[model samples]
Target chain A: MNVVLLDPSEVRADGGASLDGRRAEHVAKVLGKAPGDALAVGVRGGKLGSAQVVSSTKQALELEACVFEREPAPKRPITLVLALPRPPVFRRLLQHVTALGIERIVLLHTRRVEKSYWMSPSLEPAAIDTQLQLGLEQAVDTVAPDIERARGFKAFAEDRLPELAAGARVLVAHPGPFGPCPVDVPGPVVLLVGPEGGFIPYEIERLTEAGAQGVSLGPRILRVETATLALLGRLGG
Target chain B: MNVVLLDPSEVRADGGASLDGRRAEHVAKVLGKAPGDALAVGVRGGKLGSAQVVSSTKQALELEACVFEREPAPKRPITLVLALPRPPVFRRLLQHVTALGIERIVLLHTRRVEKSYWMSPSLEPAAIDTQLQLGLEQAVDTVAPDIERARGFKAFAEDRLPELAAGARVLVAHPGPFGPCPVDVPGPVVLLVGPEGGFIPYEIERLTEAGAQGVSLGPRILRVETATLALLGRLGG
Candidate 1:
């Protein structure tokens, strides 16, 4: 863990807090901190700063006080629209995107997306938080990404997408004869990535009608996770 | 598997080849290919095309004929110099980077890296091949990436790096007050990445002395896997 991240409620007004569980274990073992050692700390949905270790043990740690005074990493102006993948893939993607500093995520089921994926326990709120928190700690960021589930492709594309992507350049990544994916796009980008086999032809047509340009990532096909990071990285000016 | 990759020796002069093991199992089960069904096929370090199944059983298949006429994905020009990570992370990275079409990987040890990481089974040839082949299958590429072992930081930087990095722009991804990493660097690139805790000051200094420029990947710290993808993605013009 790069930073010790805690919910705002976890810290008292006096800037003191008690931490246990994974974070505590990380402090006790990975970091091997002694009492009075200053630690990098951050408040969820808030700023980043430092805190002093008041007491320490194998399973828990107490902070004498906390002071979150620095701003976290700048949030990227991107909204990721991803087809729900298998549970394991979904979990890893969640953690990676969160670490990359995305502010919003829209999870919708494409035609090829297995319906079983939505039933995955990884979609649970607590499980989702665990992955996102891991990301926040990894990137030393505080803004938890807002995740919205827009049931299926048609509903999301025909009803919700038009308005949601109004001022943003929406790009759907698919293989075909199309322009190369844009790099260093200015302003906001709504990147839509499909399932493993890619969005069906009709689905791509619908997305095009919804004002998203189909962009090819070349002949080399990448896994959705790799493509997501690559697109975001290339687009992040 | 995107492409059924076979060694040149696997195919005869008459274009007949019998596949067993995973590829055969995939054809019999995952792909459900029937006799006379054509499947995309490629030869390692060679061309990509299709093959027709002449016979299929639960565990093996016979190809009536194989033809390789198409080229695989264009090989990328980046060479990655990574500080050895814990085994599991290294395995995932090996797969991910290979899928990204990297042609060369130079694994080395840095001060922050644990000595035991070198003893990992993941470093074994067969184990490494498993990961690389996974990437080749994922990207539908036929070429296996070349792996080089640069055992120690000092020796590699002082001895090997100078000549290997001579004409290429060598950029070390390190966090600091350095300028932003250059994107789409012209020609060849020898990109060096440090281990999790990052290279100590002295290592960074020696790297700089070896004609390597330190480039910052911005404030957000990314795991070596994510950062590798991001850097290579942004640099792959």
Candidate 2:
């Protein structure tokens, strides 16, 4: 873990935090932290700071957090609307997008997406939280990303997408004669990426009519996770 | 598999090829190819073409390879010099870089790299080939990337790096006061990335002295794989 994160409930009124379970084990074993050593710490939805270890044992660990400047990580201006990837890929994309500082994610349904993917346990709130937490920890950020699911492609494109992308430029990543994915795009963007076989022609036309412009990522086909990262990076995330 | 790849040994003298095992299963079960159905195929280090399924059975499959085109995927002009990542990360990275069309990879030893990482079975030629094949299949590329290992950081930095990076812009990915990585650069580049904890100051100094200019990817810390993809994408890979 790049940073140790604690929830508000875990901290005492005196600014001291008692860490147990996974946190304690990580601090004791993986980090090899000792009393008096300062570790990078952050409160969920709060400030980032350092915590001095007060005492440590196999059972529990204690820390006295000294709040410092409240500087958050760079915010990603892009809102990702992605066709829900397969379960294995979904897990990595969650961690990757979070680490890259994507503020919001919309798990979209497209024609090529398998219906079974929506039933995977990886979409559970707790499982997603765990992956996002790892990403937040990696980026040393306190704010968690907002995630939502859209089960109907047409309804999402014709209804919800227009609202979500009202003030943002909407771009759909597709492989074709469309303009190349722009680099260092300024301001907010709502990026839509499709499933493995890509969006059906009807779905693409619907999204295009909904104000999403198609963009290509050159000739080689990249996996959904890689393509997402590549687009985010190109947009200066 | 997006593309079925056949090595020269698999192709008969008359340009007919027999497939079995994994390739056969992928063609039959996954892609559901039948007689007279044409699938995208490529010969290793050769032309991209279409292979018509001539026959299919549970035990084996047959195809008539029509070498139609010499078009390979767009080439990635960047050569990657990366510290050996952890086993799982290494496997994914190999696949990712190959999919992104990176043709050369040099696995370097650095201060933060664990000694055991060098001993991973994932580094074996056969294992590496498997991962690269998966990537080529995903991208529909026929050529496999060249991979090398450098055991001594100092020696490699002082000796081989200068020669390998000759005539190419040498950019090192470091999280510091360096300028943001360049976008859409025209020409070949040799990109260096560090291990998990990152390269020490001494290693950075050595690389800088050896003609590598450090570049940043903004504030948030990204995993090595993410950073690599981000930089490559920004560079118009």
Candidate 3:
């Protein structure tokens, strides 16, 4: 864990907390923290700061004090609209984007998205929370992104995407003879990345009608997971 | 497979080839290619072309005609120097960078890198080739990267790095009070990324002494794989 992140409820009224499991193991072994050493700490959806280790053990770490001095980690003004990938890939995608600081995520349905992907256990709330926590831990951030599922491509294109793209720079990452993905975008951006096979022509038209301009990542076709990170890095950087 | 890649020996004198394996499965089911269908094909480390499927079954595909007119996929002038990641992560990293068009890769040993990582079966030549081929298939590319193992950090930094960094924009990705990574670079670049925990101060100093200019990715700490992709997209874009 880059930084110890705790839920608000985990901390006592006096700003002390005790953590066990992976975080504790990280503190005890990976970080090799000793008693009285200050450990970087943050609360989920809250402030960032440091906490003093009151006690440290292989499986547990107790914090005697915490001081919230700085604001939470910054969130990128980017919302990722991804066609549900394979279950294994989806897990990694969640962690990757979450680490990259995407503020919102939309699990979208496109013509090429497999129907069975929606049934994967990776989408369960608790399972997703685990992945998001892993990302936050990796990035040393505490902000959890809001995630939504858009099950119907037509409904999402006609009813929701237009509203989402009204003021945002909506770019659909499609392979074609088109412009490059923009960098250092000024405002909010809603990026739609299709499934592995890519968006069919009809689906691309629907997305375009929703205000997303088709953009080529490059000549080489990229996996959705890698493509998402590349886009976020360029856009957010 | 976005593009089917075959070894030179696999193609017969008449330019016909039969494949029965994962590639065949992809061609049969995922692509749903029928008899006389033109499939995008490439010779590994050779030409990019198309092959006409003479017959297709769930487990095998036979090609009766082949045309290789186009050049191989382009390779970026970026050489990556990475502290070998965890075994599972390494498999993905190799494929990731290969797909991103890195021309050369050096898997280096750093102070923080675990000694046991060198013993991973994933490093076997056959295993490495499989990952590279998968990456080539993913990106529709035929070029493969040359990867080297640098067992000693000091020797690499002193004996080898000076020559590698010579006349190249060498940037070592390290967290520090350093400048942002450059974009739209004029020439070749050699990028060195550290282990998960990061390179120690002494290692960073040695790298700097060897002519690497330190650059920060951003505020957030990123996994080596994600950081590498982000850098490639920015530098190669």
lDDT of each: 0.88, 0.88, 0.88
Off by over 4 Å in 3: none
lDDT of 1 at B148: 96
Give the per-residue lDDT of model 1 (tens digit) for B1-237: 889999999999999999889889888888898988999999998999999999888778899679999898777778899999999889988988899888789998899999999998899999999999989998899887799998878899899899779789999999899876776666888889999989999999999999899887678888887787777777764
Which prediction has the highest DockQ against the true structure? Answer: 2
RMSD of 3: 1.7
Q: How do these models rank on TM-score, best leading? A: 2, 1, 3
Docking outcome class, model 1: medium
Model 2 CA lDDT for position A25: 83
TM-scores for the candidates: 0.97, 0.98, 0.96
Over all chains combined, what TM-score does candidate 2 have?
0.98
Q: Model 3, B7-38: lDDT tens per residue?
A: 89899989899899898988888899999899
Fnat (0 to 1) per candidate: 0.70, 0.83, 0.64
Which segments of candidate 1 are over 4 A away from where they belong? none
